[model samples]
Target: MARLALSAIVMMMAFIAFTEGLRGVGPKKCCFKFNDKPVLENKVVSYSRTSQRCSNPAILLNTVAGRQMCVRPSASWVKDLVTYLETKNVAGANSNL
Candidate 1:
């Protein structure tokens, strides 16, 4: 019985450590407001309405030196910007045809 108890304790400790390690491994949660620093329109690479893996919707943008930036989706300006980009992309594709 004492050996069994020791084995159980070890398993529980291992489970806790595993869970803690996982908690630190995923993407960092982020929230943004409209009044924050303006993201350049020309720098936007693409946008995703809702990232299934992310906690909230975000706009993907290319920042200085090719880094990516995730911006909040709730902003009206962000919506307009996405629409504009989509239309621009379509138009560009058509012109190439």
Candidate 2:
């Protein structure tokens, strides 16, 4: 009886570990439309894998764009991201198509 209980406990532990730890359900990345074209400039990043948080450069950095739109993500955003290299779209849609 004791051996059977021990076996059951071990089995339960294995089940829990497999379900929670060994799973590989990471964030998925996909393309998004920007400036009338698909912008794939940023690499697919996960909240857990990113070394640093998502941050915008200082207002000084955007001095060239006329206005500064500096906003940083406070918390980790777990989701998909389109890599710049993989995403590409033409400027004019009617002519290109």
**Highest TM-score, which number?**
1
Off-target runs (Cα >4 Å) in candidate 2 are 22-24, 28-97
Residue 80 shift from truth in candidate 1, angstroms: 1.6
Candidate 1 error regions (>4 Å) = 1-35
Clashes of each: 0, 4
| Candidate 1 per-residue lDDT over residues 59-78, each given as its tens digit | 66554467666666667777
**Tens digit of per-residue lDDT, candidate 2, span 1-97:** 9999999999999999889875555423222211222212233221122222213211111223343222122321211121221233233444577
Per-model TM-score versus the true fold: 0.53, 0.28
Each model's C-alpha lDDT?
A: 0.69, 0.33
Residue 96 lDDT in candidate 1: 100
Residue 21 lDDT (model 2): 70
